[model samples]
Target: MTRTARPRHYLMCRPTHFEVSYAINPWMDPSKPVDTDLAVAQWERLHALYGELGHRVDLIDPLPGLPDMVYAANGATVVDGKVLGARFRNAERAAEGPAYLDWFRDQGFTTRDPEHVNEGEGDLLLTAGHVLAGRGFRSVTAGHAEAQEFFGRPVVGLELVDPRFYHLDTALSVLDADRDEIMYYPAAFSPGSRAVLARLFPDALLVDEADAEVFGLNAVSDGLHVILPEAATGLAARLRERGFQPIGMDLSELLKGGGSVKCCTLEIRAAA
Candidate 1:
């Protein structure tokens, strides 16, 4: 069966208020200051690239105190116009949860305030007809259950074993949902989660530790075109061999905050 192509809509927040004020995650170092100007320049180029690719791009106003708000994918997970709001684990990002919820509500989505802590799409990734949720560093098992109930879809809970790969987006990426194809790092996940991945996506592309460390798995794909980090040369080559066009873009500035292409963009899906 031939899959129909749909133009993807993404929600992105400008790095206008971006900075590493505190060290909430392992990747963060408050002592090391961020180059705000360079961050904005790179982000603008990415935004322009999305527009050039014929995808719709939307923006959310960046609030002053929410530095990590630039990682828009953590805002919410929207499936079929129903939004599952994020309940951030850290007090530093807690306020961002409601801010994102309000944006979704204003955009006409039926938003569900999560009872448990989940970092939106950052932890709850959709592939095929299931929601693969990650739990360990940031999200809880309860959030996975809530996602399953809220989306009315099967939620496969995966445990992230590595501290650097705190979010699922950091270790795994769904390349082609229709084909059930994914790219991931096995060591980042628990033994049980790895088994689940093997059973479900046996033909999955596995990235090496070098590529995974560069946030290679944190990519965004429009089925045909993949937007990934330039540093992941090996993964990029594998994508090309698999018949997908891999477009490499440098997001080095955002790497300091533990984010890349996928982190800066949130997919907005239409109702089924």
Candidate 2:
């Protein structure tokens, strides 16, 4: 397999106000002390790595109260230069939707405020022929249809069965959108969804339990180079075997809030 690298434009937010003050999902625990400084350090490394890989990055200012704002991928879903702003399910992250929307508007990107409760790219992953939408936790089922109508692409609704993998990005990764290549943890999705995936991508990489536990599936791929968690050694090896350059990173501090590389980074895609 020959994988080609593509220049990517991404939006990111600094972990300036990052802290696990409230538990929204299975990964977060307010009782556990969060090192805000360490989270910032880890995030900076990821940001710098993107630059080193020749990717264009844009930053959004983090608000004081919105600690989860650091997870910029949850801010909105952008496809073909059109932006569909997120509507967070949890009240703790409710304000994030508007903040991200405002940024897009200010930047002169065509934006839409979604009607359904959509947690942005956290529950939305893009592929060649479909927008893989995940529900059963963050994004509502109707959000799938809304995305399809907005983006003018087929939307395959996949149900997330595991609480730990609350977001679709947490359980699956699109390694090369051009090649329609992906890898996922079957346990993170419902049985029916697993079958759906099998039919869609017969050669999808199936990751083990250990890799999934380390938030390994929460990865970012720029066609060739895949940025993932350092703890996901198993998944990294698989990616390398499949002709991808897997660059491992440490965002352990952000994991306390239920996110990793894919969560902290939002892709800004233009019409191909």
Candidate 3:
């Protein structure tokens, strides 16, 4: 496939049909349950915000048994025109892949399925030649390696220790690709993980612990855009200072289920 510049399209799952309204995220303790209506409202806000930002959002049909399917982490990605679906490690979330695969096949996507267990769009980040794959919790070491081989690109595994940063998008988000700058939270990432990140993003900025708790370390869309939790006003202001247009929305419901901006959305294809 010849390389042609493609626009980066960000995708977010609408919570209207999400399963697991109980706020039962695999990473979060089962003791803390979620309220259904609040969850719905939170997802609504997020959807509205993303829609206003001009990103193409393809909402999948929510599987009856998987409430977290709205997270869309198990979906497929379109890289160099080939569609790849995940073989997930989380038993409860595995169902998401087939649903997305059905959609991709219907859309005429040339699909590739990984033999090893791999998290979907959540664990992979593509930057030209480098593909940073996340390990620990929802994703595994073997999955990361399989991802590299599957994409036929060099993959760097970022080790995440804390359950809070179960996905790379949770504690590590790319801020600027040209400068190799990222916004990250050290507490959520392991020492070795941070070292790996430093190498990828030598001028990375650390988001405060308090901000990280509020999902402030998530990705900065396109170079000039940022999507953040509405609760983190201070951090939003800081982003504005950096010449970024901050778009804030409520993701409290997703927080109850241990997900935020990056988890709820997957930028499947983007313009370099």
- Residues 60-90 of candidate 2 have per-residue lDDT tens digits of 9999999999999999999999999999888
Better of 1 and 2 by lDDT: 2
Best by lDDT: 2
In model 1, the clashing pairs are none
Judging by TM-score, tell me the better candidate of 1 and 3: 1
Compared with the true structure, all predictions reach lDDT values of 0.91, 0.94, 0.68
RMSD in order of candidates? 1.4, 0.7, 4.3
Q: Which portions of model 1 miss their true places by more than 4 Å?
A: 1-5
Give the alpha carbon lDDT tens digit for every residue of 228-263 in model 1: 999999999988888888889988888889899999
CA lDDT, candidate 1, residue 264: 97
Q: Which stretches of candidate 3 lie over 4 Å from their true place?
A: 1-7, 19-33, 270-272
